[model samples]
Target chain A: MSLNVVSLVSVGRHPQSGRARRADQDGRAVELGLKLVAKALSVVHVGDPDDPVLRQYAGMGLPSMTILKQDKSIDAVPILSQFLQQEKIDIVLTGVRAESGESSGMVPYLLAHALGWPVVARVADIVSVKDGEAQVLLALPRGQRRAVSVKLPFIASVDHAAEIARQSAFALGLRASIESVESVGEVDRIRVDWQESVAKSRPKRLKTVKAKTAAERFKAATAKPEGGTGKVMKNETPKEKARAIFDLLLEEKVIR
Target chain B: MSNVSSLGISSLGIVRRDPRKEWIARNRLHPLYHEVINEGLGSVVGPSGLIRKNPHQIGFIGPNGIKRIDRLKGNGADTSNKRHGSAQEVVLPLHVVTTPDFYLVVVPDLVGGRLSSHDKDILGLAHALQGGMEGNGAVVAVCFGDVKETQFDLAGVDRLIHLTGTEFEGFTPEARVAALVQIDTQLAPQHWLFPDSIHGGTDLGSRLAASLGERPATQAWQVIPEKVVCRGAGGSLDIARQTPRIVMVLEECGNAIDETRHEVLPISVDALEIQSAHLIDHGQVAVDPNEIPLAEAEFIVSAGNGIHNWAQYHQTAQALGATEGASRVAVDDGFMPRFRQVGASGTWVTARVYLAVGISGAIQHMQGIGQCEKIIAINTDAGCDMVKRSHLSVIDDSDVILSELMQLAQEYGVNDKPSQENSPEESQNVA
Candidate 1:
């Protein structure tokens, strides 16, 4: 049976330049969807149809994309859920979090709750789909992975561990058609009270000395900071040096 | 005659001064002044019978043969004596909440059955919120599955709800969320704090928030009772909003509690309605070290252009069980894959230990490893930037070090099995 795979796309702000670009995880989601159902993959966006960033995602060999043209103040959850239900999408793919707006990473969960479907988060890959179930790999901390199986009609959030999105082709993106649809969206009321400003860099927590006595305080103040210059082994034999390195590896528990 | 009498008395341990001698010593030009005035004869009792102490006589001779006075009044001496004795364990005061007026619930991501640093930070934030409000508010830590953390009291947990069951173990977010929902109904905490980390905290917290239908503050760095400052727009913009019921906090949001201990009172829910799980977990997959991404790998062995024997470098990395990485120059030379390149231009790595072989660290390469905890550099040039940044540097040829390291790893693997067997034999011999 052919799978109805849909990838949600969003305009991303470059972290360094703060310019409009294709969202990293969303592009990966599209890449994964393309790998799964190549010709049948449908790309959907909830924001402006004229967002030039949308074309960059199309540049990854997409034939066309659908846009539910809406305003920034409106919530995309209701509109996207409605569209997904109407289309009867078997597999819905999205980035773990949007690179714009609140970036709360609640879209998939909220959508899953609304549709009564299970949502797999931080998915590294979908290994296979068989017997109305898909075998998925979830990314864990420190390069670990967990295998899980969820029934179809589920939502999966593509993780950074997934295969990176292919580079965009300018000509292919220009040739792809962008379909625009006017969808009614609810204005987010709770966000009206929020105050937004440029993020300030957080101060690094310094190692504090809670000295009880004057002598202890003096020693704390006079003590040299740790780990400044490294220990260089110049005259040691190769065996000794290798032993030192091996000891550190053992200390770090990197070796089994 | 008086000096002889005084010397006789001095032999009996009575410090009696001869008056005539003191007078002669006071008269500097007297003939016997040199004999009376010795090195330590600085102070003497007056005829009025008052005892006198010489300031010069109190101090001992220094290394330079000059007397040095200790102005600390022997406090330094007492401290030195204490240092030589056994060290004392410092115990912090306990903070108890008898009748909690409210609750600030915290769900820590106890990775590997222990409290991670991120979990401690969130617990700290929970206590800060509890302190900010009026009345006694208890910080409740709801831990799922096995707990190896014994310092929950030190981590500022006033109450603990440890849910240990097979249902709550290993990738069971659905069951865990159900338990949290039950706790919410029971305690009705004022706020819920979770570490905004990838280690199941964010996932569990988000799941709970969705089920509770409460909008949560994600990536919150600064939080107060009245307001919360969260990083939005992919950490570029700060959004200050009214304090929400659920808050997912970033690391370093508040200081970990070190000054006081807590009760760590164990609590439990009456009954939890665990929902049937739709997702089935198959446990963790065994991932090869080489297949792991360079950015996420905890241990990396990176090579550079100085490596002539690429096969040996790969063998060393394999033996060390480390992910392979490469310097930009190595990637440019087509000796390694582009994804293996580590620099500002390539992937930034946050490995715990980074072992660089022959990489004369470029500025970009240094930038990529900025978050690495320990770096070991093996290079011929001791003055290279990599050596300067590394915790341990070996000035030698890369080929020699790599070969030796590989041999050491192989021998260690061989030695481990025998050591385990020998331990049993040695214990039997002792018996």
Candidate 2:
């Protein structure tokens, strides 16, 4: 059997601001990492330092999952490369990029190039691993799929549509000891210099139109030749019975 | 033969190229890259001397965007001073990285309308990396240097790792993978980077990651020094090393550098050589039983749960072409493809004409029908997302709709005639 390492699963933890962190790690970014570990020989995990509630995820041992104490100084990319290489692991799974680090979705491309492996993007399935080759499924835009074949020792980015992402039984959410490793390679560092968003002297709220339910949408859908009853305007001429509405200001004297 | 197969690849054969393939070759191919691939093949070198990509080390994938097709396409025109207005013009945004020598670019030749986009991305990134790494350090890319897009202030970083082979064209994912792997082995750059899109670069990053053991993360929204967060499902998140491990960033995601003062740098080559060049292997797909040919599918019933009622389904199925299917409610209660579903997340369909009854419009479902060019939907609510987006929508009840429509099908032999010829633009609406 091929050397499978890592316990990849979609994981969830409520954002620090959201009152409560999420309980499930399914159907989310961490799930991509979880999926990468779906078939693991042994796995290690690292977590944010302040979050202790995240500990219960790695207890069950059938397919081991581990967690590391997250230090602000260490990034996940290099440590992960070290883990995979040291284990002689053959495949790695992850999302295109994390939901949080959305703007920097370049880790996989970098890691693949660094590890000297092929990185499959939007990969839906790892069909098989026989004779050093791995057949995979790729999901394209508009949900189209194409079956691609590549030799192993590659990384595949999981698609959000791959599956609902299997959930872990609550009863199995036991705590496990997560090993800690000092991270290496600090590329560039900057001093802590921060600024907060300045509040306006007179903060104004944005006016919003809400779509509470489907019925309120008749105008958007049915008013045009396009099938919906809602009116959909076409190209307009400047002077054909033009109408305008004006707002009157009360004498209090100001609108910016 | 499918015209797409002409290039031995599956992209649309619609060639949008300006017949400048030769011009592309001259500027694109760097002597460094050409020399490496050629020399590797020339000398029967083996894996002994190659710099195998080490997962234990760092796998830094750099950003390689498309070459700007039109020089002024994205210019903000910040160069001219504004004689009026309190605001000053901002310098045009450049996405070069802080370190150049610490990265290597991996590129496949061009294809599609993205050649220019890819070229710009690669060059922009190269400029960013080289700009940052100027005085010292070097980033190694995994290309057999038929072309390289590097921008350096000094000449030291101007190098290419070209692979020699026509099979390494842009769309040849398999061959590209093999060559990238070889390059990683020979060049030893930990972090691999490439641009998102704009060039013909797709799947090259992910595919390359799979070939190596390193865990690869895709889709990053931003990359700050020491912190690399990846976005996934439920505001899903994945971080690259916690703080330290060298994070190889693509140009757009990481810190920006100065590219305006970029100057061409010339570098001496080590004459790296490739011992072998061949195809990369992609394994196989497990065939699901339901995925077999449906030509023999007798009375095939495909229900878009979007179809709200049993009544309109029967009518629309008959009117356009197709056998009626139970609504999701009816099916779940024991009538539909309890084993089958349609649209993006469900069973992919290849029917005569999928009777889209009351189905809502979704990008996922649309994907399964890229091959199916025709769709007809019906529902009592004219505003159903599916119907409005379909080729035709009959506003009526299923029972009345189906019974009357089946009569039309039986009379006009609707199912016997193909609806494939419906205007494609109008037709795309249904799926």
Across residues A1-256, which tens digit of lDDT does each residue of candidate 1 receive? 9999999988999999999899999999999999999968999999899988999999999999999999999999999999988977789999998889999999998888888888899999999999899999999988889999999989999999899999999999999999999999999999988999999998899988888778778989998866776889999999899889889889988887
lDDT: worst 10-residue window of model 1 chain A: A223-232
Q: Over the full model, what C-alpha lDDT does candidate 1 score relative to the true structure?
A: 0.86
Candidate 2, residues B45-138, lDDT tens digits: the string is 3479864543322211111222222122112242211222113443433323344445445352333222233344444444454444435335
lDDT of 2 by residue, A18-135 (tens): 3323233223324544454544434444455334443444433223345554554445666667766776667666655443322244556667666877666676666667788776
Which ten contiguous residues of candidate 2 chain B have the minimum total lDDT? B1-10
Per-prediction interface RMSD in Å: 3.4, 17.1
By lDDT, the best candidate is 1
Predicted model with the maximum TM-score: 1
Among incorrect, acceptable, medium and high, the docking class of model 1 is medium
Docking class of predicted structure 2: incorrect
**lDDT per residue as tens, model 1, B142-219:** 999988999999999999999988998889988998899999999999999999999988888888888899999999
